[model samples]
Target: MLAIECAGLTKHFGDLTAVDHVSFEVEKGERFGLLGPNGAGKTTTIRMLTTVIPPDEGTAKVLGFDVRRKPDKVREKIGVVLQGLALEFFSTVYDTLDIYGRIYKMNAENRKKRIEYLLSEFELEDKRNERIDCLSGGLQRRVQVATAFMQPPEILFLDEPTIGLDPQSRRKIWQFIEEFSKGGYTVILSTHYMDEADYLCSRIGIIDYGKISALDTPEGLKSTLGGGDIITFGVEGNVDLLRSTISKLDYVEEIMAGDELAARVENADEVLFKLSEEVVKAGAKIKNISVRKPSLEDTFIKLTGRRIE
Candidate 1:
């Protein structure tokens, strides 16, 4: 069963359209990613899916419940961790989750079991009694995520879940998300971090100006940019001289030379051979050379004029 579905989902704020005819489907247990830069309609889309707001046009369904008509049913099956920290600074982590459990109408015994399991899963058990204001940014993020899972909803929506976290905390969150999927929970996450999406999502939808520019698996998206490889090398001598030499090469379409020279080449090995010999003849020192496949950023740039900062 599909956990989430949107058919031409759109949202407008007065005259401006925040989300424009967006459509996609996330399968059950899939870790789906909504990728876009700020003001690209990612948050707006999340709000609509979570039934926090209604769409001006189009439709969305969460866990088979219509977000517009059956909002309560949708809300009952989904967990949301938004970009902002929704915690009360004066409250302890335990109390914050306890409150949500009560709101969900979880019985005392079940709530206790759920809270204990979540605290341990998120590694917040030791700091359960600590006030939100007393925790570091990473710890606070963990609490926010743990609170979302306290209800054991079938679907979870996490917007920038690891934004302020350190490397260790970020990895811990990733592990928890993976484990959540393993336990049959479908995760829909929004993030500007390309590496994070690449690591966690089974499929990613790249959005911009409220529209989906691309949708595919990470490897599939990269392949859409074509199969060519990128070759980058460093030159110790004059950059201008290197630029003039490399730009004229037939296989090199784009040559950007600075402290380093990067080029999009049709044949990586051939270009490297030619460049190496030419640099030697020009009396320029060769620092390093590397060849890599196109990245998710590369695919984003190819479709949109801007990068996903």
Candidate 2:
């Protein structure tokens, strides 16, 4: 079953079109990623799906309820941890979760049981009575996540959940998200981290200029760039001449030269032989040569002319 679906979804703010005819589906119990650079409409799309804002055009359905017509029903079935910290520093960790439980209308007995489970699971039992402002950033994030899970909704939407976290804290949060998905909950996250998307998302949608430029598994997306071999070499003489020589090779698809020349070739061995003979014949000394598979960042660069950072 699809936990989330959007068709020709669009949003605009005055003259700015934040989202433009974007469409995608996320299946139940799946880990999906929304990847894009800043101002690419990822946050706007999240707001529309979570029913925090209405889309100006098209439609969206979350957990089978139309976001426009039945936002209340949709909200009941999903958990949201937005980019900004939503917690009140004056509230204790225990009180924070309790407030959410009350908002969900959980009975007193069920709420207490759920709180106990969450505190223990998140390792926050010891910090329950401590004020939110007194905890470390990581612990506070843990509290945020724990509060979201208090109701155990079927789907969770996290927007840059680990942003500004230390490396150790980020890894811990990733682990928590993975474990959360294992319990039969669908997880949809939007992040600017390429490695995070590659690591956690079963499938990723790459958005740019307020539209989806590509969508697929990480490996599948990389494969679309036409895999062969990429070789970079520095030649001691006119870099332009080196570029011209490498571009003339039959096996070479592209030759890019800066301080060095990087060539894309179908047959690395044949291209290397040709390049060696040509450079020697042209009296240019070869400095270095290395071949490598294209990374996700490479693919992004090829498609959008920008890096994900």
Clash counts for the predictions, in order: 0, 0
Against the true structure, whose lDDT is highest? 1
Highest TM-score, which number? 1
Question: For residues 1-309, what per-residue lDDT tens digits would candidate 1 score against the true structure?
Answer: 988889999998989999999999999999999988889999999999999999988889888899999998998888999998888899998999999999889999999999998898888899989999999989999999888888777999999999978999899999988888899899999999999999999999999999999999999998876668888777688777777887787777776422456677777876679867876677788888889877887777677667775
Locate the minimum summed-lDDT window of 10 residues in model 1.
254-263
Q: Candidate 2 overall Cα lDDT vs. reference?
A: 0.86
- Residue-wise C-alpha lDDT for candidate 2, range 1-309, written one tens digit per residue: 999999999998999999999999999999999889888999999999999999998989998999999999998899999888889899999999999999889999999999998898778899999999999988888888788888877999999888888887788778888998999899999998988999999999999988999999999998886887778776688878778876877778766323456777777876677767777787788887787776676677777876665
Taken over the whole model, the C-alpha lDDT of each candidate is 0.87, 0.86
